[model samples]
Target: MSDTLLKPHPLDEATYLRSLGPGRLAGRTSAAYWNMAGPFGGTTAAILLRAVMEHPDRRGRPVAQTVNFCAAVAEGEFEVLVRLVRDGRSTQHWLVELVQGDVVAATASTVTGPSRETWSHRPGAPPPMPPSQALAPLPTEGRNAWLGRYEFRFERGEPIPGRASAEAPAPALSRAWVRDAPPRPLDYVALAALADTFVVKILQVRGDIPPVATVSMTTYFLADEAEMARQGEDYLLCTADARAFKHGFNDQTAELWSAGGELLAVSNQVVWFKG
Candidate 1:
């Protein structure tokens, strides 16, 4: 891992939240900036969730979040405003806005829970690959920022040729092994930040032109950090659909797994392609 990746101190929920007070409205950028691709939708969402989890009322439960990217935000100082949409004994809903100047760059809705049904099911797992054989070495330098903090090995497919070529067809699917560099166990917030890593691969396989920038991502945390770390490995399987459409938008679904093959979370996003 590079020294820059190791620079930011790991923060628990409380400390991270406290850092965002009045004087600290502008947020910290992640090491994965280059891999962020389009507008920082995932970063905006992650920051908002960090704020929500930092609130006094949060009880360290699973949170289901839906975020919409309304506009692009340049990397730098920004503000997040969180509102309590509803609070109940078992669940809470919050609305968050990511702001830069007068613009609402992104908006999100979050639902935190204390109770939910036990029954669970997920789509079929991706084909298995051994951790020892599959782990890709981390790149010494990255085209985008986030690549520095992670060691990523693509298990399937390749990056589309050229940066702006929309003429190429999207691949059907892609898989990758991802681990944090200098390997520290990450809490839900940190893991959520990593989950945004899925977008680049999804777009790589989704269309010939690869305009699949993330519009929003919704994640549900299913287990604790210790459990996630215990699993030994993390794999991301991204599949996209070109069919579902609304208001000129399309949706793609992604599933994440621990090394033990347990389902970690599911993400769905709306993407708009540039013509």
Candidate 2:
């Protein structure tokens, strides 16, 4: 990715109509851009949110998003269309569709809102780990890669370097700091996308082969800019847990924190893997 900062504009009817042309996926094929698993649900959400955030009208704000994967997107040209469902003073709703040759590969709905006081709560923050402890760098080389578009530093158990790992006991807990390319300040939407990074740590803990892939993820924002910015760096401490299991599925929960141990967001993702 380029070091240039990206400022997105709102998706008006005119821009949406013109965006029907070929879309770029980090300079790669849109389909293969984020095929972490066979399904690109989380990737779809990331792309859609990035596009929506670029919109001139709703560039900086908290947004709630839900996406449904309809079909697999293969490598090639594609387009995204955004529709304004409702635009209110405090909140706005948008619908986005990913299309390839007239095929609807994926779709998403997002809601953006300003901070308002309805209720509040303070929960105990996750235990801290010294940043000076043995930390593993993210694997960025070879095929079947792990961390691609993000930079990370493990604060706990050693992450199996490269794409392959010798089967061993999975750790009960792990912590890591995550950030995107160029390490600029990211908004809530981008933070939500980064929250999914813990899925790798969770699967590693479970000793699951082929690494489990996320089916769905939901994140709740818990802090304001002043709180987030106070962390010093755009980095966030992510801690994950694989608490329960059933017929071929597992539940994982992760919390995002600032370097000062301030909780910024919490996330839960349903993951499944093939034997």
Candidate 3:
């Protein structure tokens, strides 16, 4: 069966992820969607963050969030519990856990704070990305169901999962322009998903796909709601690369930038993979 037959519009999926009450939320999986194993990690993180955002006591926007995948999340009727760990005048911290039948499938911690002018500097420059019109859309035929849900135009190091590289996996990187299919408005929620959407970079290092799981991940938002709204459905530039891989584990770092060159977010993750 094709994913198109089972997947609903992304916005509908996002709305359904909203919390039912204070620190309480629920969700079901789509039969049509699958990522190497269970549901997508990005969506799981977004749903956990949504729980905190829906909390009646929630304050400020999300400045940073860290999610730990304790175990695989089984689809259908999952519950998320969010707690206000700390509430301060300028910042709020929250803890969330997604439980499936008494098993703590995943947990997340978030820091939300008011926006203030501070000494700002971006020491790194954005990668030289080609105009959206200049690159061709990455084909999604015969791939994971989730790949069909986003638009990607790769500049280098495209996801050739399950295939061996010409030589060795020297340049473990993937740079592209990406956005949701049917184009959803950019938001912290959506941005959270984008952070983990790329295929595991370690696959590039090993020259083939192996058993892999993202053990932990953290994302830092540099822009607020206003910045997300300004971009509408436009595609954003993204670059992901692995720094080291050894002992069945690897660390990867990624950068996301607006088409206009504004640094949007930076993300890092640790994944367990078979050597």
Q: Model 2: how far is 34 from its true place, Å? A: 4.8
Per-residue CA lDDT of model 2 for 54-119, tens digit only, reads: 665673355466655566666555577776678898788877777777688767677777766678
140-228 in candidate 3: lDDT tens per residue?
98887777778999998777665545365658788999998877778888888889988888666556777889999999988877778
lDDT at 34, model 1: 37
Candidate 2 C-alpha RMSD relative to the actual structure: 5.8
- What is the alpha-carbon lDDT of model 1 when measured against the actual structure? 0.60
RMSD of each: 4.6, 5.8, 3.6
Q: Model 1, stretches more than 4 Å misplaced?
A: 1-26, 30-40, 115-126, 138-142, 162-170, 199-203, 206-212, 232-248
Cα lDDT listed for each candidate: 0.60, 0.60, 0.83
TM-score winner among the candidates? 3
Quote model 1's TM-score: 0.76
Q: Distance from true position, residue 215, model 2, in Å?
A: 2.0
Give all TM-scores, in the order shown: 0.76, 0.72, 0.91
